[model samples]
Each structure stands twice: as structure tokens, then as C-alpha cells.
Target: MNWLNYSEACARNQAVILAELQPLLATTTRVLEIGSGSGQHAVHFAAALPHLRWQPTDLAAHLPDLGANLLRFGSDNIDPPLALDVTQEPWPAGPVDAIYTANTLHIMGWPQAVALLQGAGRLLEPGGLLCIYGPFRYAGRYTSASNAEFDRWLQQRDPCSAIRDVEAIRDQAHACGFALERDISMPANNQLLVWRKAV
Candidate 1:
């Protein structure tokens, strides 16, 4: 299946995210990527950072296209894709050294986002990292005009899919036993949010 071809602004920012992620993930042995859409970022990062094993996962329907993209890159470090849905009653896998998801939260409703964070907390070992990348609202304001427009487009497509407030996300992370580590601003108005599981 072609699996619905489309491009996202987030995909264009992968290299910038990898630059920030590389140093923090230098010692990480395994990384579980949620919502591995198109598998572009996973293949690119796994090829760039050969030391860390990248486990790309998404809904079962998305696996074929994701796998095909991974094959295109031919990176040994990227493991076969896994079927994972945050809203499911139980996750399908074990713990991971780190969890990464880009531009997924805004695509999901608030409840699903909370469930994803809770599941991440459960799967991450103490001191493990959770990295989320995407545009977000901060202090009741949009960080950029482009992001504001993107949020409008998102809500138009799905009322539940709107740019999330950073503060609310931080609060949810805290409730899930995660501590906010860094909020790095990236190109194209996106932000890289790093949270560490409390030790």
C-alpha cells in the first residue's frame, strides 16, 4: 500500500532535531519512536547515529509503508517496526532507554496525549528520556505566526487536533513522574521538549 503520501513541516526539521538529540542520546542503547510516520526520521537518525538502536513503531496499518521507507535507507541500526497505539488498553512492548515522538501530540486529542505520556512514563526506565518535537503554545501565546496558522489548519481538520499548551504538557509529565529537562527552540517554529523520568 502507498499508505497516503504527504509531507509535513516537521519532517523538514529532522536534521535540526538530530543535532540536539545526538549528544543527549550518546549513551542510550535503545530508542522507541512513537508515531513513526513515513519512517523518514527514524531511518535518517538511525543511519546517522549507528550506536543507538532505533525501534520504529506505529499503528499496524502504517507498518508497511514505514518498513518500506526503512528499507530504502538500509540502516542496520533500525529494527523492524512494531504495532503500537497509545490509546490501547495495554502497550505491546517492554521498556526502552528513550522514547521519541515528533509532531504526534497535536495530532491526537487531549486524552490520547495524556495516555501517551502516561504510557511513556510506564515504559521508560528511571532516568530515561522522553523527547517530543513539534509546535506548541506557550504562556497563552503562539510562538510564531506560522505555528499559529498551522494550529488553525490542524483544528480545521480535526477539532481535537490543535497545538497543545506547553504548560499543560509539563504538568501532565510531572504527574506522570517526569521532570522537564529542556525546551529547545528549533527551526520552523517547532520546539524540542526533553523530559526525564524521575529517578
Candidate 2:
């Protein structure tokens, strides 16, 4: 029962992610974080924004590692890890005011990624915010040569895992009761896409 993992990238980018989410989550009472891997962002964000409750979730197999990380760095505002698989019918009970997930889309297949958006559509309250952070291609082109290499590396590991298209995600968001709000540039060729659940 030793579940421990470390993600240096999560530590490095936690601040940037928090800065992006601060204003967006200002009035949000509850926020659900999908793929809360290592729980680093969960602890950092929850500690910084004490007003909002942070609910961390991941696949059942990933829960223990997340739980272990939370135990070391968690704040009072964060909740226990919940099991969440995007393809599973009926996501965890919620009408959450905000959702935050990082580096998840490219890791999951296209269909699973779509399911994630669809599940977020169902769980989010009207006007709720969903912030997705990852590398994305635009118009079938990679943003940078490094990104192209990264995509190749990803596909080599798992064919289904590769950077997604921005337009495709935008279209799926529209279908899932979301309206594109902002697309922010981030460090290391990553992008943060924000969408709001239409009222």
C-alpha cells in the first residue's frame, strides 16, 4: 500500500496555473479537478484560494497516489480523491462551479477526451468555468517544432495519445453547452483553454 509518485513539472507550473485560475475561480464555491495527478496543483491552489472547496479526482487506480500526495501537501479546503473515468456513465455527483485539469487531454484518446468534455458539460453548473491545460495543434499544424517532437514521442508511447486540435476541441465544447472564453499561451508550448457553461 505504498502509493507515491512525484511530478517535477507539476511543481514547476503550479504557480502559472494558479495565476490563470485565480480570477476565474473568484466566485466559484466548489471546483472539481480531474486527473489530479500527484495532487500538487490541488494543494497549491486550495491553499492559495481558501474560499473555494477543491475536489480532486482521477481514475480509481490513480487515487491512492493522489491521496498520498494530498496527505503531504493538502489544505483544509481540499476534498478526498474520487474515482473518475471519463468514459464511465454518470460522473461523480456535482454541479461544480469550476473545473480544472492539466496535461490530461493529450494523454487520453480522442474519444475519452470528448467524453471528458461531455461529462464536464453534465457536471458543471450554468456559467461555470472549465479550464483545460495542455498542448494543442491548430489547423492541423503544430505550434512549434518541439511540440511536433513531443507529439511524436507521445504517439510512440501510446498511439491514441497525441496533441489534440484546437478547433476540434472548440467544436466539441460548443456541442457540450460550453462557449469558448479565452485561450491563453503558457510555458513550454502548452495552452490553457477556458470555457464557460452557457447559461
The numbered model that scores best in lDDT is: 2
Which 10 residues in a row give candidate 1 its minimum summed lDDT? 1-10
Q: Taking the tens digit of each residue's C-alpha lDDT, what string does model 2 give over 108-185?
A: 999999999999999899999999998999999999999999999999999999899999999999999999999999
Q: What TM-score number comes out for model 1? A: 0.94
Error in Å for residue 139 of model 1 = 1.9
Residue 88, candidate 1: Cα error in Å is 1.2
lDDT of 1 by residue, 1-199 (tens): 3323435654578779889999989999999999998887887798888998999999899888778877776489999988998989578766788999998999999999999999999999999999999889998799998888889999999999989999999999999999999999988788899999999
Which candidate tops TM-score?
A: 2
In candidate 1, stretches whose alpha carbon ends up further than 4 angstroms from where it belongs are: 1-11
* Error at 117, model 1, angstroms: 0.3
